[model samples]
Target: MNPTDAPFVPGVPAEHQPATGSAPGTPLALYFHHVHPDVRHYTALTPREFAEGMERVLAEFDPYRPDDLLAPSGPVRPDRPTVLVTFDDGYRDNLVHARPILRELGVRAVFFVCTGLLGQHSGQPREDYLTWDACDRLAEDGHLIAAHTRTHPHLDRLPPEQAQDEARASLADIAARYGPGPARLFAYPYGGIPAEPGLPGDVLAFGTVRSPAEPWHSAPQAIRRTYLPSGATGTWDGLVRHWRAQWQPAGATARPDDRDDLRGERP
Candidate 1:
């Protein structure tokens, strides 16, 4: 079976495993790309749709920032399960639309930026991406601004030296812009974990696992995140249809109007 398809077996090294009765609950990490009024990509979410999805997420899990896990003391054990919401490629709409909705909902998310691409416009207004000042404001707003390489290249395909520069320069750029603290967290561009491990040991890098509800063990250097779906399949209507099938009794037929979003409903 593919590693991405494999179940998340708990591999907490014996010495680091939680004490009896203090075992950690599953922590879901989700990554989104664009949040615009228009659906720019399948990963894009309109502001209204984004807000609704966040509400649904909150009903099931408490919010967590990336550093909450990267801290030396390990992640906090909240009363509920945790979810870390993150965005990649540093799109401008994240600050424009998503920020207001998240601010209203009291959730702080992580924004992984490519150092080289900031403020470079490609003629398309919406694709202008985030500026350095924008990223500074995001940091000031209490959102974690992390690294996503200097240029958004496939590290696995690049030459080793180039890969090293791409990975290292991103961290350096974050540190220079903000400070050393934010440099420790990273998300691989396009969810590709390079065959050559380019990042420093101290950096906690994240790649994505696409399947939902998979168990992701707490690996400090190699964290796994879920790709939050958007567009048609992201709406409540689309999700309810899929979830109803998953939650129904083994032989029970799902009714046509089994349309509940299942908020706060545990299976």
Candidate 2:
């Protein structure tokens, strides 16, 4: 079977439901780039490994609803641990592989897509990245579709007009292609969130990092996310061990002095 057409053996939800046993107090957002049967990028995780990671997460954390995070007036539930799974860069495998795992586990996730790059091939089969129809299917399936920028540019480095245009054009494109009710949630390209980050309009932007859900306390526009490390998917134990630390707060890692603009290897 083609990797994109891998069957969705939906895991048993009764067996994988989020346990009510976690001590609440923090929120975690996990961001992934790809999911394929075989490893490609260091960020790619196989379906089985992805499922294992989800199982480990379900065993401990409550699946935090994205609405609660996206809404400016949304409730911040710090009582018990909450988690939101997010996939960035509009990869096609996100719909093919990741969706089924989430569906079976009763997990709700946010998918950030680059509007300009959707429906285009990445030097190979067009299935390499998401298309408009696939994105629509995800929206229909109850997953959230948000913006990652129109061309996945380094927003901070662009001239002010171009930077704002990247932000504005993406939100407009997602609304035009998807639906039109503030598809304004965003993930900065390459996780570059300027220290003074804010779109001219209302938006909930995301930065790549591991931390407690303290975006509102600090930067409301740019939220923090825990990158799903490549090796964490090697085993269920690895998933549990690494992801658990990812759920809690930690000291900030070193950032480039020119942290305002981040460039990605692949747009």
Candidate 3:
């Protein structure tokens, strides 16, 4: 199916709308960047807002860790809401600002990090980036520590060979350092086209936004996410709209009578 096309909207009678709390056919994987309040970058979400979102989501949906969903496990609980939390770029604030609230709520998220940015030898330090120690702490606390790449770059913009190399090297380095389990999960920097021409077949890569996974999900490399940005989603209401509602339909069939529950958040 074309990722750019509309999501698989079941042909339940057009009048038969799914309730806000009804289980989605698949989990809604939510991705985020910085979670600090003081840094008002367009993508950053304030701590208080994030905490509030987590509380609401936890209350409404069952948390599904990346590994659980990637396992192709059967009997996906369609009786209740399911959500997968993921973060890109591995900012130190993931450990500093986001972790505490997640830890308290018992929600284990996946943090995809750039391997090159963690150490002194890698080059000049970006204090805002995460350290290996911090990732280890995140893992120790039950979060999935995945790879984003050795350095954060738009993979689609790189030469095919270079893109493949970046993907492979990061996977290898992450496995060497953190072991192979979590390394199975990869997230593209900038959520560039999720597929690199030559990355390993086994790598389960993720992209920024592609409709939430449909039931019977099997394509790990093209896993879709609903990215959360404080700029687009207010701290509280935005969380409810995103985590609780699906994007409004956009195909030829989308009627003028359809409610605008959610607008396009991705560029």
Evaluated with TM-score, which candidate comes out highest?
A: 1
- RMSD after Cα superposition, model 1: 11.4
TM-score of 1: 0.74
Clashing residue pair totals per candidate (backbone < 3 A): 0, 3, 0
154-265 in candidate 3: lDDT tens per residue? 8889988888788888888788877777777788876676344466655667775532343223544665676444544433343444445442322423243422211112
Off by over 4 Å in 3: 1-24, 70-79, 120-127, 210-218, 232-267
Residue 37 C-alpha lDDT in model 3: 63
Residue range 1-267, candidate 1, lDDT tens digits? 121222221433342211111113435566788888765664678888888888876775667665564555334333345568888999888898989998998888889999899998654635668999998888787898889998899877888888888989999999888787788788887666666767875666777652223222335445666543553442443332233233232454435433222111222
What local lDDT does model 3 show for residue 221?
A: 63
Q: Quick one: ranking by lDDT, best first?
A: 1, 2, 3
Give candidate 2 misplaced runs (Cα > 4 Å). Answer: 1-26, 70-72, 75-78, 122-127, 177-182, 195-198, 210-215, 232-267
Query: Least accurate stretch of 10 residues (summed lDDT) in model 3?
Result: 258-267
How many residue pairs in model 3 have overlapping backbones? 0
Q: Give the TM-score of candidate 2.
A: 0.73
Q: What lDDT, from 0 to 1, does candidate 3 have?
A: 0.63
Q: Output the worst ten-in-a-row residue range by lDDT, candidate 2.
A: 258-267
On TM-score, who's better, 1 or 2?
1
Q: Write the per-residue lDDT of candidate 2 for residues 114-142, one digit (tens) a residue.
A: 88888886644224688889988988877
- Each candidate structure's TM-score, on Cα atoms with residue i matched to residue i, is 0.74, 0.73, 0.73
User: What TM-score does prediction 3 earn?
Assistant: 0.73
